[model samples]
Target: MDPLILGALVAVATIAVLFSGVSVATGLLIVSGLFLVLFEGMWALELMPDKFFGKLNSFALLSIPMFIIMGSAISSTRAGADLYEALERWLTRVPGGLVMSNLGACALFSAMSGSSPATCAAIGKMGIPEMRKRGYPEEVAAGSIAAGGTLGILIPPSVTMIVYGIATETSIGRLFLAGVLPGLMLVGLFMVWSVYSTWRNTGLSVMSARSYSLREKLEILPRVIPFLLVIVGVLYAMYGGIATPSETAAVGALLCLLMAIVIYRMWSPKSLWVVLRDSTRESVMILFIIGAAGVFSYMLSSLFITQSIAMWISDLDVNRWVLLGAVNVFLLIAGFFLPPVAVILMAAPILLPIILAADFDPYWFAVILTINMEIGLISPPVGLNLYVISSIAPDIKLKTILKGSMPYVGCMVLAIVILCVFPGIATWLPDLVMGPVR
Candidate 1:
């Protein structure tokens, strides 16, 4: 059978299963396994274990579980509440100040937590109620939290970046550094949109700017300083050459536990157990997806499906920018249905070759891909962050949350355009600090 025809069939099967509500990991495994055996025969079965295990058996992957644990620990503590209060105190004078504070808290928490739903839950619970008390619009308040939560994957210590780096064999540290500017850029865009939208709408006069006393502002710092220290430590360890990514994760997780127990005094034995249990479940689910994506990636390579697609793209004689734009559009659409990790795991194998063939820097492309995934987290229908915020604020309908998030979605798109036009925004920091990842 023609590989293209086979690839088309595989694509159709994948879409059918995914749309029918099969888990992404199961769908990929079943589809890839069936294709491998059907096309390559029994001998290919001999190589399956090595492919799956090889993907999972990496030093880099160790960081994933640790980071998840750290995130879970933080979520189970008072850190989110503290951070929210601190930001609210500082930013309350700005237009849409409380919403802006939520965005700021999301960005900072994302730097610590590395999970979108976790970030949303952490800040949303605190921010939404606070916004409500302040007479902010429900859509604006919820939308800001949901949209800002997507930053979890774009900021450093992001699990999505780790998965992308592992899948593409890109340097995780370089990827982490690469995300810093783009993440901040998205934060700025979201803040600007929130401020402008609330200010422009007369109904939200309740969002008028107001300042806090200097002493009141200073008093909140102690609440946030412990959390910020963990973020700073992990980053310095990783980017400053003081530790490997895995070591950095280990130390960060330990600090999170200590903060929860010693500093916050929020951890009893039962609470500790709950955090452990939840983290284990989330970590196992993600690692399984990684392993399954490895199988699918290997099958695509062995089947020459990815190579065939790349060759076809190369043969088109189209400009690289056009192809890049098309790929970003496709990813944005796919993001509505798939989470960032699955998208990276599944899409990276197929897209990376074509991207490198066009002479685009892999590092720069990783940042672009990440920003695209970040948008997906708040996208309508299946966006994880939307669901997370909805669950927290059960009275608010999902449609309203989606409606409020649309402007911030525009902000994300604009960020993508900026990155495309000036790849330097993504690359400059990594180059200056890490010196180009060798």
Candidate 2:
């Protein structure tokens, strides 16, 4: 069978599986296995190289599990709750203050955990209840958290960045650094939007301006310091070349465990067991999707599909910026139905080559790609963050989640345009901090 036909068939099968309500990992594995059988023939296994699995065995890949463990440990501990309290106390004095604080805390927590669901779960638990107690509307509480949770991917130490770097062979450390300004920018955008929206809606009441005394503000510092330490420690180790990304993750995980057990004293035997169990389950799910993506990507490469697609795209007469806009449109559409990781795995292989062939800066292109994926997280019909928030706040209809997310989605779009116009926003910091990539 022609590999192109086989590739299309695989693509179609993947879409079918995705819509079938089957797990994506299972879908990917099934499709990959089918491709292997159809293209390689049943007895052609010996012709396949061992290198397929080798791609999955990177030290960088180890970061995924360590980061997962770190996120789980932090979420399971009382540290997340404490951090939220500190943020609430500090920000509650402003208009729409609690929501702004939620966004800020989500951004900070995102730097620590690097996973969206973890960010949502940790902060949503605290932010939602507090917002409700403060007489904020349920929609406002749920919407802010659902939208803010996406900062996890844009912020540094982001697992998504690690996955993106691994997929594209870009510098993971530099990618991590690149996210800082944009992440904060997005947080600021969200805060602005929250304030604006709250102003428009008279139903939402602002918290009274209660000033925190120096002692009270100082008291919250103890809770804030641990998270600060974790962030500093991880970034210092990675940027200083004292540790590779995976090693930084391992250290971060250990630090989180220590904070949980020694400082927070939440690491009861049962709690530890539960954390390990959840981590294992999440890790297995992620690894399986990655492994299956590896297989599918391999088959795509074997068919020269990426090269063909790149050539076809490059041959177009349109301006390069126009072409990039088109690429963003493509990714946005893909994000509506595809998971962010799946979008990266499937599109990066094809798109990176095209961007490079066009002589676009790799770092700039990476930031662009990252922003597009972030938008996907909030897109309707199938945005994972939306579902996570909806599940947590079940009373809020999907339509409400979709409606509430529009302003943040617009913010992300504006962010993408900013990065597009000023590539320096993404590239300059990495060069300044890490020196120019060789």
Candidate 3:
């Protein structure tokens, strides 16, 4: 059989299995192993153990679990609620201020946790009820946090960016830095839409449930400021080259745990166990998928499928922007099926070379890909975020959540276009701080 044909079959089969509800890591592993045996014989199968080990052996991969732990520690506590409350105190006077605060809180927590579902679960648990209690529309109330939670992968300390850096051999610090501007840009865009939509749909009088006194506003800071500091510290360490991504993650995780203990009094053994257990479970799931993806990539390369695809793409005679548009569409669709990390692991290696050949900056492209994944998180079929919001706010219809989120999805699409026009939004910070990539 033609390798290209087999490659197409394998790709389609992976999607079918994922949609069939088999665990992503398991499905990828089974597909890779079976295809390897049938296509390359027993000897090829035998080599996979060492191959998968070599792939997973990276020290940088350690950051993923630590990042998960950092997120889990906060989500397992009232810190997310604290973070949202603090934002509301400051922003409550503005129209749709509460929702804006939710978006802001999502960005900050996402920077800390680096997991979208955790962000959704954490902030939504508080923000949704608060918004609803204030008489915000159910769609706006739920849609805001659902869309905002997608920031987990766009903000710094992002797990997906870490995976992309590892897969493409790009600098993790640079990728984190690359995400900063675009992340902020998206936050601003979301806020703008929220304010306008609230003013239009609800009215200018809309606000939080009540106002806080100056002292009340200031009091909450003592509890949440330290967590905010954790975000700043991690980025500073990454930006200053003070530590590697893994070391940064380790320190950030420690600080978050310490804060959860000292501030939230989450020091009981069961609480600690819960954080560690949740983090470990998610970490293992991601790592297992990564290990399997390593095998899958090897299979594609061994079969000449990867080369054929890259060459086929390279040989296309189209304007670079047109090619870029096609890649964006492909990523958007792929993201709807796979989590950002899995997509990065499987696709980055294949796409990075093509992106470079097209004269697109790699870091800029990372932001663009992330925004696509953000849309995926809020869309259907496999929109993890939609279901996450549904679980948290059981009363809000899923279709309403989807409807409310649709505008923000358009906000994301607009963000992508803006980044394309000014790629510097993603590249300038990294270049200015680290010096241009040679």
Best to worst by lDDT, what's the order? 3, 1, 2
Q: Assess every candidate by TM-score.
A: 0.96, 0.92, 0.97
Per-residue lDDT of 60-149 in model 3, one digit per residue for the tens?
999999988988888887888888889989988877788899999998887777778888998999888888887778878888888888
Clash pairs detected, candidate 2: none
- Record all residue pairs in model 3 with backbone atoms less than 3 Å apart, i.e. clashing: none
Candidate 1 lDDT: 0.86
Q: Evaluate residue 192 in candidate 2 and report its C-alpha lDDT on the 0 to 100 scale.
A: 85
Per-residue lDDT for 1-438 in model 1, tens only?
A: 767777788888888888888888889888888888998897887887788788899999999999998988888877888899888888787657788889999999877877788889989988998887787778888999988888888788888889999998989999988999999999999988887777666455766556789999998798679878898889999988899999999999988988888877865899899988999999998998999999998888888888888888999989999999999998988887888888999999899989999989898998888888877888866788888988999999998999999888888889888998898999999999878655
Residue 427 lDDT, candidate 2, scale 0-100: 81
TM-score of 1: 0.96
Per-model tally of clashing residue pairs: 0, 0, 0
Candidates sorted on TM-score, descending: 3, 1, 2
Off by over 4 Å in 2: 1-7, 47-52, 132-139, 203-205
Against the hidden true structure, what lDDT does model 2 obtain? 0.78
